[model samples]
Target: MDPVIDVRNLVKRFRGTRRTAFAPATPDSLALDHVDLAIPEGQIYGLIGANGAGKTTLLKVISTLLLPTSGEVRVLGHDLRTEEAAVRSCLGLVTNSERSFYYRLTGWQNLRYFTGLYGMDRTTLERRARPLVDRLGLSRAMDRDYRTYSTGMQRKLAFIRAFVLETPVLLLDEPTSSLDPLSSEEIRSLIAEECQARDQTVLLSANNLLDVERLAGRVGKMSQGRLTPVESASDLDESLRVARIWLRDPRSRVEATLRTWAGGSPGRPPVRWEVQERNQRTLLRVATEEPERMLPEFLQFLLGSGLAVESVDLRSVDLEEEFLLAAREAEAEASGASP
Candidate 1:
């Protein structure tokens, strides 16, 4: 079966500017580098990456917002270069940036106007959008001016517009960003439900790992303009277990000691540690296959260091850690291949 979205050696470059009036101009920077992707029909393909990893650039190109420098791109068998109108008709796009909306128009008015472009009548638009707005907690502000809407409300309006269009393909860039936990969950649920119910093919680019894990059946990591697909998160790293130790201390001493011990300790289990700030507390994450063995040792070490442990949690390796580990491996491989 042909993929709903297809690409062959796609590349996009942005022009760079001169350093100064008298300095040499910079060369064009490559945004997408010979990238190839094929997302099958009715599949939610999640693309994750750090900022500026070309995730948004790829989506923009697929959505016909930017022209590709070279190679082929096809959406629903329509050539992106030659049949852009066909591609646009078949896909709905929700961008992270909120500037796409008409500030002076009310939220409902904006939705009606955008849906009008898609040939959806006001009645149909209301029927489709009212539920989404209500579900996303934006019903009260539906008639309010868009300029006065909060960042989150503006984003919800974008989603309602896309969903109302009911295109066969949806391109979502950070749909859950800047959303509170409940709102994020609602958006994720809507995404999953909408795709399954409508049999739509969704290409989602997000920094939120949980969104990708929950919504995407097939996952890929985008780094340095290259995409690496994986069967599942567990394939990212051999160590599938993680232990998080919540330390009550707000000081950096705990982090420093952990780093020093991790780097200098001998015969230690193959584990990697990360210190994160959490609500005036420090979270020390230890990734290892042998969490049971490492937990005791870690607890002893922290107590010995005079750092008070608030609590400890043991869980499977989440998508966040998997993303980090995969990135590290990709960087290592790239370095090794460098001449």
Candidate 2:
């Protein structure tokens, strides 16, 4: 299958002014620098990074909201620069900030407004909008004025408006940013279900790792205006040397056991351990390449040291950790430091 979105050496830059008008221009203020990415058709692709990581800038270029300083971008086989109309026809967009809609208009009216812009007929509009209202759990509020709705309700409406076209590609920028947990889950489930059932391609940008990990088929981290495809969540986290270990007991013996195990034996000293208590459990964190081997031995030592092993869990590595590590590494490498 062909790629739904293909970007090569994508670059976007913003010019910043110095305090003095005559100041010389500098080259470090680029927003995106030679970013490359490929998103497959009918797949959920996640764009993750910290603030100022160029995630939104990349999306803007793909959606035609912003022009690239240089590089090539194609959406649904249409060149982003030359075939913008074709790209727009195949795309739907949902943003964190609510777009302007007729406040006095009912939910159905708002959707009808967008459908009309898409040149959908009355019959087709009703047929398409009704199901989306129901699927998004907006049937009850379909007749209510959009202005009277809560933030969550408005967000749901915004999402439905985007889906009104039933476009082949959906571009979501922090779709769940302001939603409550229940509403966020509801929207996430809807995105997943709709994408699978309709064979639609989705490119989602989010700082929430849990949501991205749950929804995306492949994850990419953006930093310093570049995008790097992560092999897996595990690989990203491992590159940062981040892992969580839970201890059954939060006692002196447990702490001592962790120190002893991490400090190594008399011949070779182990790495130092970082310990913290979270909720009812003690967390033991250490930078080590052999967590699997070290954890087992640590557990055995705990048992030998007279500590009960209630539960030992290795917390799953996720996208957030990967993004931070990648961003920091990029910064370090740019500054000529060893990452």
Candidate 3:
């Protein structure tokens, strides 16, 4: 299958001015620097990174909101430069920027206006808006004025507006940023269900690692205007050698004992142990490679060293830590540092 979104060596720049004491100087800033990406149809692709990572810039270029300085971008087989109209017809975009809605108009009315612009008939508008409002839990507020709605409610309305036409490709930037936990979960579930049920292609940009881990089929990290693909959530978890261990006894000397063991081991990689109190119990995270092999011998050494033995438990690593480690490693390699 052909990629739904294909980008090759894409570049976008902005010219701005900086003021020195007596004069203003112009500088060229590159928002997207020689980025290459391919997003397959029917998959939820996550674009993740810290702010200023060019997530939004890439989205704008793909959605035809901004022109790239150079390179090729294609959406649904339409060249961004030559077939912008076709691309626009097939794409839906949602961003954190506040959208304007007629304050006096009811939610249903607002949707009707947008649907009319899309040339949707009255019956089709009702058919589409009704299910979307219900799915987004906006049934009660559908008849209320936009100005009276809370920020979260308005955001849900914006999302509903974007999906009303059922565009094949969706570009969402921080779709759940302002939502409460329950609302955020609801929206995420909807997006996931839509992707699976309709084979919709989605590119979601978010800073929330957990959200990406849960919803994305593939994850990519963006930094310095570049994007790099990453292993899937399961693969990332399996690649780590870090393990969390819970001891049976609450001994204050555990740290010293573990430190001695880590220092004495010649061939083993150095282990860093962090002790924390959780639910009034002690928890230790033993960072090392091959935890299964090391745990038995480490326990023995601890016992022989007179450290009280505690019931050992292993903890699972979450997606956030994995992302940070991956990003840091990539940054190090880019800066010519040893792994």
Candidate 4:
């Protein structure tokens, strides 16, 4: 099947001028480098990165807001370089930036202004906009001026503006940043339902991995403007993949068992297990080269050693952990090549 968005060796660079009259101009900043991606139809893809990892630049390029320095990008089989207008027309975008909306206008007015851009008739626009406004908890505030809304409220309005268009492709940057937990859940649920019911293809970039994992079918990690497709433990790090077993083990027995396992316990691989105590319960964090392969054996060792196992189910890798691990690997590589 053809990709909804295809990018090949794409690069984006920006030039800067000197601040001082006598100073030379600053070097060009490479916002993206050799970034290749293929997002298929109807699947949600997520990009995880730090503050300056070029995630926004890559998305903007795909939206044709910024042209690529080299390489190629195609949106729904249309070349971004040659066919930019078509790409823009197909995309529904809502960035987290505060400047995306007009604060002087009411939230309802803002959305109406955006829908009018898409050529939605007044009747049709009113029909589509009402439900979204309510679902996003913007009903009462819709008629209030945008500037009167709080930061979180403004963020919700941004979501409404982007989604109200109902375009086939949705480009969301930090889609749930400023909201409360329940509101965030609502936005996430809405996106999930949109994907399932509308067959929409969503490309989202977020610092929150838990939300990303919940929403995206596939995930990518970005570091220093390089993007890597991530699946399983090795995509981040073997040690980074871990499972926690929470159980109530007596102090004397737990202490002795941990010592033996840290040493050469019988029939057990020399893996790392960290023990923490919370609310009169113990959490044993078991680290392995491969979590799926070693989980059973570790569990057996725990039970066989006369300890109760409460849960091996609470094991997972989240976005913050994965992002920092990728940054470490990138830094190590750069340091090794320096000499």
Index of the highest-lDDT prediction: 1
- TM-score, structure 1 vs. true: 0.76
Compared with the true structure, all predictions reach lDDT values of 0.83, 0.76, 0.77, 0.76
Please give the lDDT score at residue 58 for candidate 1: 96
User: Residue 186 error for model 2, in Å?
Assistant: 0.5
Clashing pairs in 3: 247-310, 248-310, 248-311
Ranking by lDDT: 1, 3, 4, 2
lDDT of 4 by residue, 189-256 (tens): 88888666778888889876656877888888887788988773234443356676887886556646
Task: Judging by TM-score against the true structure, name the best candidate.
Answer: 1
Give the distance in Å from residue 72's predicted Cα in candidate 3 to where it truly belongs. 1.0
TM-score of each: 0.76, 0.75, 0.74, 0.74
lDDT of 2 by residue, 1-339 (tens): 668888989889887755567787665478898988888878888888877788888888889999988999999899988999999898998877875588899988888788788898878878877887887777989898998888888899888777768899999998898888999999898889888887888989997776787788888878777787876554555543545556667745556565555345554335324555678777655444566666666556667777666555554445654555565556655686433
TM-score of 4: 0.74
**Please, what are the lDDT tens digits per residue for candidate 3 over residues 196-289?**
7778899998877767988888888787688878676656655555565566556456655665664566765554455656665666665445
lDDT of 1: 0.83
Q: Give the TM-score of candidate 3.
A: 0.74
